[model samples]
Target: MVLSQNEFLPRAESTLARLEGAVLDALSHHGKPSVSSLAGVFRQEARLSPSQLAQALCPGPLSPIGFAALVMRELLAPVDVVLEGSVSEARVVTGNARAPSSLRVTCPLIVLGDLEVEGVLEDCGPDSTVVVLGRCTAWGLQTSGNFLVLGDLVVRDVIQGVYNDESLVVAGDLTTRFLDENDHDVTCYGEVHAEHHLENGRSGDAAVTLASTFLRPELWNVDLGELHHDALFERIQEGEPVFTDAPQAPQVREPDAPTAEELEGLDIEGIAAQASTNARAKDVVYAQRKTGEVWLMRPGSLPLHIFDGKQLLGQGTPPALDVKQRASERVTFWRKRGDLFLEIERFGAVVQLHAGQNNGSLRTFRFAFATPDDAAQEVRRLEARYTGDFLRVTSMIPGRGPLERELANYGGPKTEYTSAIVDGTTLVTRDGERQRFDDEASALSALEDWLAGKRQAGFDLKILEWKPYGLLG
Candidate 1:
């Protein structure tokens, strides 16, 4: 039942409307706001039950961001307590402000302007919230409650949320050195630039950048995905580099082999060492150094995997190949899809195997192999694994491989669903009818009433998944 800020906003407004005029007035105070104080107002004036008050406050499970938005919009906005210029250690602020070096807030704070902090910011006690309307600059932000930034967020060091349900929402760009979700929900509306980002357990994000990545930038060649969270954390804390130089082959030219003098100050040895350790090294036929650069090439390859002294750059079509060995090594495999048998095709080092049909749909799986016999053996393994019509769970190799997941829809259109906020109140019927409320408040009221009835009918509804419908528009 815990909804996002947008969904909960209308519902919160609707809940507040049921309160007595005296209770509403008492809750709307210009002084510092705390959840306990407002709850007392509801208990004393409106006589709302414990469950009722808790529902009004949070609606679902504990969410810091949702709770913060509820308090700000419902309890605090009516009063005028806006401060100007630089302020610190206050519950309400406008203009520039600085948080204490090591501050633990038990009350809700609203920052109307930019807030800068070179220390730790954490929230303790139930319903602690921090709302920054402008830019936020921090050395580290470790929050247990909700933290919402309407503008950009620049964390010089790290940003972490303690629990999975703890909410962190940044409306603009977020720049940080390291981000550990710690199983929390982090939503970034704009771009994210982080040197190291870790999504431990259920924690994740929908960021344009590689937000949920745990790989270290310094150890760019190593894939630490196989390591457990604890091991990864320990390694990172110990400052242990994960990469070692790949064993050199005689055919592979040394970046310093006479060509090192061509590009002075360039780390050719370093680049060559790193390139030899990349995930795509299996497909790399050879590495050739030109003036000012080095090329990692495959058979009939483009200038995709080019190294410019510092790092690998510009991955173009048929990636991980240079133009030298364009027609060197080729592997092929035959694929049968019902009555149609297709000839094998090799694009660079990738070998595509057409697996049998599933649910009357043509399906194919790709694997990289150095020889045709190796490719054929993989095809036989694929055939042996398919019973054609059996459903069961089995273990798979880990990492971001498709085989790791249940083979539900081998290669169909994929759509990812996440928590999203819509503009208006959302309504759906048991018969699949889509409805919307005229206003935000009305939408929330209706949905709450409907859910209450469903609960009474003996259904346990923990989370609600919402999908957009044409009629809703």
Candidate 2:
């Protein structure tokens, strides 16, 4: 049931119209019409069947007008040959006692074997041995010895009388008009025109500027004879390698660097002796240098300990204006004229503990701590480890001269407004009521009228904690 080219062209034109007058009377008496006399007139007048008369005949041995023009072009272009290996879509006219080997045809092919053709191989006789693995358009591609086109041969004009020896590897483009010397060794890889004199044989590794500017330029045209266009353009800009051989140099080396026993077995430490007092040494507890405060040293100290690194705070001591005649007088003061004030106050408020200095003067003094209850338990452990806004005494009344308190941390809302402003115009609200704007569309129309509530009655409207201020010229 292999009939499908619209049912095998109307049953091969109704069995070639019932054996077309006995195949034109046996091609007028044997001019060539014997596949057992057309399979006995297609098994008795076209009832067909010896494999449908060998699928309507045309597998080799054809002559009666090339088998009636290949059965009228296979009943008008039916095409079906695709065979490989023991190929037999046959149409060879003679010459095959089996000498060549690899096959692979695909229609319109005559072969003994070594013929690859992937379609489009025409009239190749003269003991044909075609090899085209694809793309070859020939007319009288007569071969008596060799024709190994791996692709793109396209000869239509003057590629007269074929005769090949060994080297022939096309790989595309070899147009043809005058490549005589039995088509010189031929090693193409694209581009070869051949208008005239490529003298004789030998061109295996092709491409001496594509065999002298397109195949033959009369055998290397030095502008037709004397060599000088800047010495052939400096030998094709120094990349001279036309018929092959110049490719070697590529060996490079450079890698070595890790050695001190491969960087101590890869624990690696060598940026110029990475700190090694015989390794394993770490006693710094705390050390600071870029400006002030962290000095500490209890590991084996020489006295330093000014710690602001989580407070231990003062002891690099030395400036002693008779610090109460020293001898570790650790604290003792009641000076009304040389600062020390500590007042807390907030339970029933009486707050007044002033002490600012760093040159912003404000002072009052009254301190005593030669371990006054371990310095009031280290000032109640720095007011329970200070989490911002400080002051925390909440009841201490021992007063006869100095101790008196009741604070519990109080320092909120000291009224300083001006929330956001980093070149984003200005906004200030926390009830100080100040609006200075010329841009940011009048500070977003007074902040959308204080967020649509237009605030002001009993003014407690908060939400402003921004702080970067500068007023010093």
Candidate 3:
């Protein structure tokens, strides 16, 4: 009888408009209708019946999303509001103001000024957690489940979106500089950045994985990693060792760069042994973050964990090498469906692979600890398939250079930490061609490749995005 949170959002939006209009008329009449037509449309306009609108939209023991995430923690985690001691206007100042979205904590969530959120934002409620410590502002921040911020929830400025299975954090620094935009599907479990754009507008395919999103075309569906920082590859090319390069400034110097005799016999020491690796990547990618706990991923993955049933969250490694490409290098190994993958040097962030023999057994590919930009920002929240398009990778300011070395460097297509497949092509770099494609549902099918100079005649494709460590390699 405590029914509040705006009276359960108009009775869960009228039971989600009568369960989305009787599940779209029983899937458009293929028909399986009887729950008595979802209980006669919730007893005609929510009078309630037909099994109380099918247990209030499928609620077993009070479940309409666990009773609206327990009435959003009994009405906004005790928020009363009215600051001005340091500043106010719905400002959610916090020392510990009841934030715990799965505890990681460090400090940073300081709003300092300007905020105006109304509904949503419990940080994905469920035990209702949040780990912010300083710097967190709001013009918008909506949530329902699982919110975990550690520091720098800086809008410096504006936002507006955050639905929720939940996770938005900033351990050390993530300055949107002045926001106004950066919604890339609004799902960061951790590590997001902005100097200019992470996603303020062309949000694009989003399902994100930004450790740095200055935005250009750094879209996502899954697996996006960045560390030293490159802002998330953007050049759009797909098909033929995935190409893009040519937006320089990650480090600065141009007047005519390229000359150790044009970078000496290529592979420049395997790009300096993958920029001396150890930025972290020894096969991670795991899910199911609770109970025994798991969230260990680095070379990236995550779109929503689909249903958030959340499981797995294992595997972990990748860190030793650094002494500059282990001394000597030439990486670009290959193996598609059988397993084993490699395509570093230019093609980056495609870790481990493995997995191939499931039903018949034989799938190991381990790596027990090391990939964590907050487990590689949970790979944007799962769900991604690839084939073509992308040449993105940018930088303009003190941002960075050496093409940000694909953040940690791995290379695409060749999944298997959980999903399958292996080997997805990787090679061709002079500047970093963020993307290239032929077809695979045009997000560039995990960076395609078959080569033959990508059948060039006059070929001129473009799709590059750039920043936090947002994405690269």
Candidate 4:
């Protein structure tokens, strides 16, 4: 019988452990194991291929250069050309040529004519170098050592320098899709252009134009410029747009707002019953379509709010006074010392606790709790924690700007289609029209259709995410 995944995993792990011990014993017996000796051990025992052996030896991540070197060593491959004598010895190529898919050079290399590399061009060790007298083209170019180009250098995908000892010098223009240089120097005598540039290293003389700058997680010390620390984190986590400016709000022409007469004729109670039956419904209220706009109403035919296709407009009076009183009684707030601002307010059935200080730098924060009692508990916790330090009260609560943006523009990274799931209903905004789906499953199917169309037009498919903000820590 075939073992289940749970059972198979343990057996697989134990087998791997035995294989590792056998390999280790074989290495000890051989003293200095070469590729041929390792192959014999693998064939006789584990029967692992060169690639699998490499993976077993280095399970986790390795630098691109290091990975390529390991693969070459496991395959017992030779370099395209070898330089004799010392490490400083030079190997010269007279004409244009495409380098091997993977190359590791121990000595300096000089190409008099244009050089093209389909894959990676890396160093065997530190101080191993490369020099191109003419233009150079590559898919991926990396160096743990030094590299110089007398002419222009163009990389289709990525070009990076490793460690503080490496230096990249280009006498002419440098162009790449992505450029990463950290703890090293990249000197360009002419212009430098990249689709995405990451620089945490020393800058050199070059006119640089970067379409976007990648902010890696490790480089938190880099200046945020205009963005706040929390805001930056939110943007990255939510997959929101960072490089571009805030998009202009779409000019939406909504249908006329439903008046009291329109509400009187419709069976609002029946609509509410249908909405309540949906398993995904969270809020007390539900929506019904009138004309083209959607109206939000409670079970008792109380029209609380209206959405004009895109924008939410408050039209009706607040919910019943009894409902408000019940919500208010659960929450309590007390400020002991310095001047601070705190208030409990309700939008529809949802209650929000707004807290902040008067200082301009300290922003007002809006916290949405499931119930007023929860909000009250949070308030008490924050008050007691910062009893002596009231000025820094805003630190506990973050601003709602990021959350708001995330809700309004809910789409995959670099997607133009705007979509959001509001109260169990999916709303997709494409072109100038807003399309509504009664359930999330139907909405996901619609989104997939759009992604399929994009894929047909030479673009990768990216489906919309319902609520990416839930991933926030």
Q: Number of the top candidate by TM-score? A: 1
Give TM per candidate. 0.30, 0.19, 0.21, 0.28
* Per-residue lDDT of candidate 3, residues 204-312 (tens digit): 2231323223323332222222221112211111111111233322321221222333233333222222323532222122212221211122222211111122232
The clash numbers for all candidates, in the given order, read 8, 2, 112, 0
Q: Score residue 473 of candidate 3 by CA lDDT.
A: 34
The worst-scoring run of ten residues by lDDT in candidate 4 lies at 399-408
TM-score result, candidate 3: 0.21
lDDT of 1 by residue, 336-433 (tens): 11111111223355444332211122233344667656756654553443323112111111121111001122232663211212234555444344
- C-alpha-based local distance difference test score of model 3: 0.27
- The alpha-carbon deviation from the true structure for residue 351 of candidate 3, after best TM-score superposition, in angstroms, is 37
- Sorted on TM-score, highest at the top, how do the candidates line up? 1, 4, 3, 2
Top candidate, metric lDDT: 1
Which segments of model 3 are wrong by more than 4 Å? Answer: 4-79, 82-136, 139-154, 157-195, 199-225, 228-248, 252-473
RMSD of 3: 24.1
The TM-score of predicted model 1 comes to 0.30
Q: List the residue pairs that clash in candidate 2.
A: 60-90, 60-91
Candidate 2 lDDT over 216-277, as tens digits, reads 22223321122122232233324332222333222221112212331232212121123233
| Ranking of all predicted structures according to lDDT, beginning with the best and ending with the worst | 1, 4, 2, 3
- State each model's C-alpha RMSD to the native: 22.6, 32.4, 24.1, 22.6
